[model samples]
Target chain A: MTVQARSLVQITAPRQTGPTLLDRMRRSSLLMAILAPLAILIVWECLTRVGLLDQRFFPAPSSIIVSLFALVESGRVFIDAAWTIGRMLVGFVFGAVPGIVFGIMLGLSPTVRAFLQPVIAALYPVPKIALFPLIMMIFGIGEASKWAIVAIAVFFQVFYSTLAGVVNIDRIYLDVASNFKATRWQLCRTIAIPGALPFIFTGCQLGIGMALVIVVIAENFGTQVGLGYLIWQSWQVFEVRDMFVYLLMVSLLGYGSQMAILRLQRAVIPWKKDDAG
Target chain B: MSSDPSTTLDRTGLSPPAFPKIRVRGLGKRFQVGKAWVEAIKAIDLDVQAGEFICIVGPSGCGKTTLLRILADLEAPTEGEVTIEQSDPSNPLSSMIFQESSILPWMSIRRNVAYGLELRGVPAAEIDKSVDRFLALTGLDRFADAYPHQLSGGMKQRASVARAFANNPEILLMDEPFAALDEQNKALLQEELLRIWSETRKTVIFITHSIDEALVLGDRVIVMSRRPGRLKTEFKIDFPRPRRVYDLKANPEFGRIGREIWTLLREEVVGP
Candidate 1:
């Protein structure tokens, strides 16, 4: 009977076709997103060229592009971008790994949650950048202090998000796992982590944005070789075009990191594709 | 029907005939709603034979789900006990199919069907073979690679049912598994389930609110009273095996049993 049914299903099932060109274009939202920003840049360029706006504050898009090219030719852009990316990566890894671990621990154990909740709640809202002087005293105003500030900023975001994710896992899924007689380790591996992952991804995305913001602010104090310092240095020297160049780099860095995280989410949670459709 | 209903014995009054598959003795459950403790099931006593299909029909909030949950060992009974005779040590005693399609949304149809066996540390080759067999049985072979969200509600429930059957559990506990489906899908699934049940002969405890559903699918239908659910009545259905759900609806005996069970159920629903 099963064999007969299998053959019947195969014969009756519709053939899957390759996506058409219009379907492919519709699926790629990134192309549409680029248009809006491109339009804004064009309008900004026209306004600056025709003297509708002050050139001192708002440099022409063409002049900013030229300065961007000049920075690239000097190889300073590469150095600054690498430094900024390295600090963000290092800080994010250091903060997020432990944050997720501790968050899971806290989420699963009410006792641990009771002991740690008050402390986390107290420190979570304090702007981490305000603690720069204190961190600088402890780590001595080098890359360590900047790294510390960025890590602290990222830690809270990942921790709270992960905690929320773990706590909010549907009880029915857990009941299903237990009913199947899954061991604790198997439950965690198969059910808990996969169930909590969407929210955890949201946390990581938010952490990345926070990390970029804090790293830039942290660089303002001690660093001489990052995009943040480049922006500040250009401003001190009264070079509007150079400042705009650094600002554009910062924007690109933020955009690039966000896209990277989004790509990771897609690869890991492939089932989410149907949710959009 | 040629079968005799009188041959079936009520567990409350008579001892089970040798080696019952499941035994529930004075089972009860109570939940704390706010400050007060509310009794869900005051007591339930039942003995299920090997390969018997038992359907439980009850009013809403009658703790039918709670009873099923206790049998699945998903919840602890506040009082009494449930014991399952482990006929096979290799297979799990029971696998439950929930009211909602509990197929993990992250897993593809094939993987969802393979989940229970995989969790039991069954080898990959065996899982593949079993998954293939059950998927074909459920007519879901064409959708093996599709995720739960990609499938329709009926297909999702079919995948979940396939998952339970593929595990080859000794007993299947289903809590209103087809209640959310449309009429056509529900009837189609019921027939598919009967075919699967006949082939496997696994002891089944199916919970439902519909008397017609109970009459069509079960070898015996057990009715329960309202809140603090207690076993009120049991009817031995004499419907022959290999019965089609649609055909059963037209049977005069089916309507007779449905009306009898509905009268028992309506009292709990309408009060007094």
Candidate 2:
């Protein structure tokens, strides 16, 4: 029935108000996304069954699914996923809030920006993960260390872009604010905050990605309940399927949270929604 | 050829107002461009009567904007004083309609129009009432909830006009408010503005490069010399009140006034 509809639409595309090929493809894009990986897995399963690949390193897709089910049934996925997400959220909130405030300050005052630009510029280029050891030593090798590393990483991402957003607001808007006899508080509320919101969101997207990268690495030590530690432990025990399961959790966290932030942005700053038209 | 304008208005004793609303004495402005000082306007002295519509016309880069900015208190004069008498203490000192669209992009047309009042902590009910009135007056009633990015250029300019008028400031400072509009929209907006101005009789100081625009809008046109912009001369626009732009343009007297101002402006920029 689907095939008949497809051919009929193709023959009389312009006349019919039916969904365009692109729209139809978009509906099936998720299926396409699933199909490609499923095809790869099927090829791998055949390769393994024929003994062309080693099961020791390259397990069959079916067996991997069995172990994935075992991991979920054992309740290992729930606890570890919670620990990792909690650390990221706590760190992100801490970093992003202060970063935005400081960014606004820098944007508002040229003198403040001038004095601090050198200090921030010198630190911005430093690999945040490189400071993990130093952070662990200072914050102690525990959840504090994990949270601290994530916060520091996310701070620069949010801070610089927030400053850029505020700085780049057209001068006329600021002039308009003053012409209305706006006080300092009114200026920030009316002009600075709204103007900087777009760049702040961009910074947050980058910050979240950075958080995912650093959180997994930070979990390598000083933590045992996160997906990062689960992946590392599975690798040590040669439980390849369990390792893949934990890796999937990390990917979902990254993808899900980015989409969540975008949703929130669309709601909170609805004025900056997708396009001018 | 139009005769040259006198270099000083005070010396010539032109149409002096009995009660000046704004008095400017030897006003000058200089900006530091990199290392050198670029004088924007020099030793400008003038007086504007209450309820007068004054237009400042000069060539491009002739500091017309700078003069308006100083009047609006957006910039400080380097060498002189500008004093605007407080005719109505309850009302705001001034509201400026910028060369660029000054309405905030994040705000809806209603909120943008109500901005000055909102900042002043006016009651929300009062804001809703006055804002709706101005929105209807400017024909932005339907677009009250629309964002600026969704509107056409002329419509955006209308939102600004609505905003400035709704604020009910004592003086209206406009810096080429219609410069970016096409001729048709400019004419329509000019007519709309005249209707609004006639109702309010607000003191307006407008800046423009077009002599025709000045003649169409101003009670008097002040001409300025090119860069280091000194006030070169003035012309009184005696055309009747509540004028229509098309009707005024069709009149032979209007073209003669525009050319008289234009020739004087050209001579001021080049030579006598």
TM-score of chain A of each: 0.85, 0.87
TM-score for predicted model 2 compared with the true structure = 0.90
List fnat, each candidate: 0.73, 0.58
RMSD of each predicted structure: 9.6, 8.1
lDDT against the true structure, per candidate, is 0.87, 0.88
- lDDT per residue for candidate 1 within A153-265, as digits (tens), equals 88888899889988998887888898888987788788877887888888899999999998987888877889998888888999999988888889999989988988898
lDDT of 2 by residue, A17-115 (tens): 779887887788677688887898899999999999998888887888898898899997899899898999999988899889989999999999999
Best-fitting candidate, scored by lDDT: 2
Instruction: Superpose all Cα atoms of candidate 1 onto the true structure and report the RMSD in Å to 1 decimal.
Output: 9.6
TM, every model: 0.88, 0.90
> Per-residue lDDT tens digits of candidate 1, residues B1-272?
00433322122323346958888888899999999999999879998998999999999999999999888877778888776777666888689999987888878899889999999999999999999999999999999999988899999999989999999997999999999999999999999999998899999999999888888899999999999999999999998888888788898888888888888888899987
Model 2 lDDT per residue over B1-272, tens place:
01323221121123245658788889888999999999999989898988899999998898889988877767767878766766666778889999888889998989999999999998999999999988988999999998998899999999999999999898899999999999999999999998999888999999999888999999999999998898888999999988899899999999998888889888877877
Question: How big is the positional error of residue B109 in model 2, measured in Å on the Cα after superposition?
Answer: 1.1
DockQ numbers for every candidate? 0.53, 0.54
